[model samples]
Target chain A: MVNERSGRAALAELVTSRSVLVCVGSGGVGKTSMAAALALEAARRGRRTIVVTIDPARRLADALGLERLGGEPLPITELIAASSGLRSGSSPTGSLHALMLDAKATFDDLVTRHATDRAQAERILANRFYHSISTTLSGTQEYMAAEKLGELHTSGRFDLIVVDTPPTRQALDFLDAPGQLARFLDHPAYRLMTGSGSAVSRVAGAAGKRLLRAAARLVGSVALDDAVEFFRAFEGLEAGFLTRALAVRDLLVSAQTGFVVVTSARPEPIAEAGYFLDRLAAQDIPVDAIVANRMTPRFTRLTAAELRRIAAAQDAGGDQVLRTGLAELIELTAAAEAEERALAPLHTGRAIPFQQGPFQQGPFQQVPFQQVPFQQVPLLDHDVHDLGGLEQLRQSAFDD
Target chain B: MDPSAFFTGTAVHLVAGKGGVGRTTLTAALGIAAARVGLEVLLVEIEGRGGLAAGFGHRALGYEETVLAERIRGRSLRAEDCLVEYLGGHGLGLLTRPMVDSGLVEVITRGTPGIKDILLLGKIRQLEQARCADVILVDTPASGHALSFLRSPQGLLDAIDNGPVNDQAVAALHLLQDAARCQVLLVTTPEETPVSETIETAYRLEDEIGLHLGPVLVNGVLARTPHRDTDTGHSNPDDPDPDDPDAEGRWVRELGIDRDLAHAVQQAAVFGRRRRDAQRRQVLRLTEQLPLPRLEVAHRPDGIDDLGALAEELLGGLRAW
Candidate 1:
């Protein structure tokens, strides 16, 4: 039911809109590629674009053909300066840039920025709970990703920004995390543990002193002394942590943000995507679109039986099907049809189905000095590392 | 039939729950327990989270089976790798890797919409048929996606009127239905969302796929204090008598704790017990709808880090069942 013109049309709409585009899905579903493609399409149409990826794997960099990215945004200079003569030397149109999120470092920066002093910052950092939360809390990385996206959006450097999210469930965590952190910050037990000494605090302190004496009598002074020191260190910065947690909560529930659930025709990912969409709706987050990637193109003249026979023969160790490969033809056609059907309901914006490439084993060895067209780039071997690779990937995103 | 009777067969046991609910950890534990009882087990994970390997404390697992412990092995079920291996073994290795590569495997596997589910199920079926394992413990995707995977074959069969895929679909369905061969165990935490999802998944599997649902393993269940009367007729230790001034004195004297500290401890303990009782109510609700046993695995204070704790908690007392 998708309008033939809708894919490019949707990209154009996104180019002009001021809203944020958040791409979310399960791992290995071509989400990164789709985000790049959207960003590329926007840039080609003369809109300034930036695509940010929180994927730890340098797939975005490989897709963009960049060597590496830091915390800050880097210009995708190669794509703009390509000598291919197809479209070279910074078209008077616009520009594209990309950045990968380093969540732990970003969180560390946030703590330092928000803390009152060096002692307070170090105290918060040194807390076992904070260290565990900052590094390994299940959803902390994804939340940090959203925080980075918000930072980029606030900068006003680009007309459009496409964010490729982490795994689906974790991405939802990004949506829910600020609230969870707020609850932890506001817990009564946390208040009792951290507040300046009051009536309850005096009582708790007297009880603690007696408990320590009893513990010293039973298990020796060393263990009790260590515990007392740990508790004492926690008393300094409870208010500051609570304040920052509240600020982050406010930042999340703000406007100017949107989500797009990206998925393929595969059942599990589609189902997960649908679940995510439902959750997003429940949370009042706006889902602008669902991008179904790698749809199979329908073919003519080949019946299902004929395709099966070819597959069966191919399975039986025949080279005829492999050389001419009616099976591949059949598979491609079936994929297109499956994608169309799977994405039939979400045809409101656009359902761009780029041909899905195979999983790459490792990084590419050669650097192509010349302009490499996206389609001719190795289907399986190439990794999306930088802006050049992303631009090449973007070039391959249309009806061609 | 006894609900647990489903466990004593050549069945594909799918462990499904919400994220962060110890589904993967439980799957590994079930595999180890089943293996110890002499069932050759293949623990499968589709998410590529490396949870299986991490749970079993293995370095890493691949598309091929890697032995983690005695009789318990792990495999990463990559659809493309499986197709490539099947094709190469069957003599289509001559096909250009690109033609086989560029979404061809995914198309054939993922064609017919839910065909990927059928393919994944087919892969599991092949492993079962090859006597690769007596029990295939699938660390399935989360509830929604897991249901989709289970319902995929039926989805395709319904969509396509008749075809080679349909034939394959029917065969897969037959394999799933023979409860003597394959069974599904719904795993859940005692939270509102995961428990609700588990109940819905059970009904959907039964209604749609005709697969026999097994026991609901409610992991991380809280434990409550046993109620008893003291000499003073304080019927519930949780319920303090404000009328009896001696009650407070007695509590402080007996536990040798301050009134405030004792009150805090009592409140925390009571809160935990009440939470568990609420969870038990949900479990009882599930029992009313499905003719399945509910196994409660009590919450460990430190949390489940590896499979060993899982075995002790899940299978340690199952002899009574």
Candidate 2:
């Protein structure tokens, strides 16, 4: 069931050939670490690479040897130089950079860039409604992530860009963001809100006007006026925003981009990965590989009956210590086997009956996409928190 | 040591943790545990695809509560639905259809940043005040958004001065601050990243949000016997244990085990030992860093099918706590 060649070759191709690699998975599944390791591989192969991470733990920063990452890309090759043990000339063309996504700051920058004038930008920026939406709106962060990717891709400074997306279904929002923004910009209600006349005056019916007044009263007229002003100021910038949003959409589905779905050997995350594969396949975005992280090592194939016989014999021999020890060993092997069973749907074409119900199948059961590599990273004894740990991860992921 | 008080002492329990830390499953297990104590429990999941209901072996949950078990009811909440409900409560019931269908609610929710979260909390507050259930278990968003979700009420209170929305925020904030009304239950695994995030989240919740926290749940900890690994003696035939004479020979000859099998089992044992040791260190670190009670849930080999067993284990943990 282990296809080392395909897995290694696919990973190599991802870093070497693809311009953009977006790693998506449920939270706490080591998606961030996997992304960083893949970016490190690209850097080591002499391609300039940058990894854009979202809400990574502090230890992951320490792992990458960066003191801190903010909105701007910071060169990290020098930071990891001492720990990585690289001589000066080895892969000299290779370079690595990293940045943490600041969604609010990115949105503000977009507003400043697209606005017709500084006064218009300031008018919108100073509005409380604008401030709130930019920081707290559901799709803003995801749209900003897509915008940042588009920015970096246009910069053409790096050969490879790896994005560690936000967790769960929100990661899918990052894909829909561009189109959602474009559609909203074109929505008639948005135009009505930003219409030149007073919003109440523009409503044709008494009921429409009454509901608008009620909404205004519920949120308070002061706050509602601020929203009106913000949208009015935002009207002229729509063309630029629309053009950029469409460009981002184009970049996401282009041939240079690839999606790598990361998951663990757990049922929930595997189900999530399957959902992601189905979504991406529906959109025709190519998935480069599926990384199954933190997999327990399958050490033995011995059944519980065989192990119980050994333990019972040891019990008869009066070596109770050996008996208990063998029992614990049996439990460990059984657990490893369970992990393998959990991961089977990702590899085997057939669906097996779970204790609860039939196993949920993903795009892995379908053809062509079944050719996508399944790279399994064994659960290491120690937690991964530094460049050394990342190097170990890279070795396991890239080396056959 | 009685866990009945833990169930009915608070009106609402917000179960929160990083994604994949089993927050939803733990919420379901807590509801089951509460129901076992003869309390009617309402499991509330926000912006999820019926994960809480699925935990109880049911289909997706809607806005209306459905009986999931003997005494447990579950429902799912979305921001838009909460807004519609909020509007209806404000005597705008007739306006809901046109407003929702016309994208006005979406516009209002999008225009205001924290309003969506505030609306959800406001609904939860209403549920608590109306005594809809004996206990309400809210499975909140993952840790990344949990802070913002909890902070939204206060954020709205600061942003809006005099309005119905402001009044709602104040009420939600009051509920969150009232120790008898609500408490957050944090869940984490005995791993470096999760433990670290849990500790940070605990302090932030206490200091920033001024919210009361319940016991920290250390989920998926490896359960081990209190026996030393070396006491099993060496399985290496090339280098027999001097402490236990002919231990290897006895294992292969008397125990009917081959040397290769013994060696493989020995490696497996070593791996298990190391994994357990690492987790122990993490648990110890969590104990030393945070000043809260810790509840340990053992790893389940059977996965989702073990929720009932986990609920029983949680009740045992609460009893000990």
**Whole-model Cα lDDT of every candidate shown, in order:** 0.57, 0.78
- Which portions of model 1 miss their true places by more than 4 Å? A1-5, A46-48, A82-93, A126-128, A195-255, A301-303, A306-323, A335-389, A396-400, B1-38, B42-321
Stretches off by above 4 angstroms in model 2 are: A1-4, A56-67, A78-90, A196-208, A303-305, A315-325, A348-369, B228-257
For model 2, residues A1-400, the per-residue Cα lDDT tens digits are 5464588788889898989999988877888888988988888878899999766344346457555777899887653453365545557677889888888899899889888899998998898888888888878878888888889989999999998887768787877876787666655456556654455546645655565677776787777777777778888787776677778788778888888999888877877777677678778787788899988766566765677676665546555445554666677666667777788876764443321212233244443445778788887766776677777888788875
lDDT tens readout by residue for model 1, A39-63:
7666665668888888654557656
Largest lDDT belongs to which candidate? 2
Candidate 2 matches the true fold with a TM-score of 0.91
Candidate 2 lDDT tens digits, B1-321: 688899788999999998889998899999999999899999998988666777666867889989999999999888878887788888878877877766656777777868888889999999999999999999999887898899888878767777789999999999998999999999999887788889988898888888999989999987664444322322334432223435546667877777866665666655666667678888888988998898999887545446788889999999987
lDDT at A168 for candidate 2?
61
Error of 2 at B84 (Å): 2.1
Interface RMSD of candidate 2, in Å, is 3.8
Q: State residue A343's C-alpha deviation in candidate 1, in Å.
A: 4.6
* B-chain TM-score, candidate 1: 0.84
Model 2: residue A90 alpha-carbon error in angstroms: 7.1
Clashing pairs in 2: A63-A386
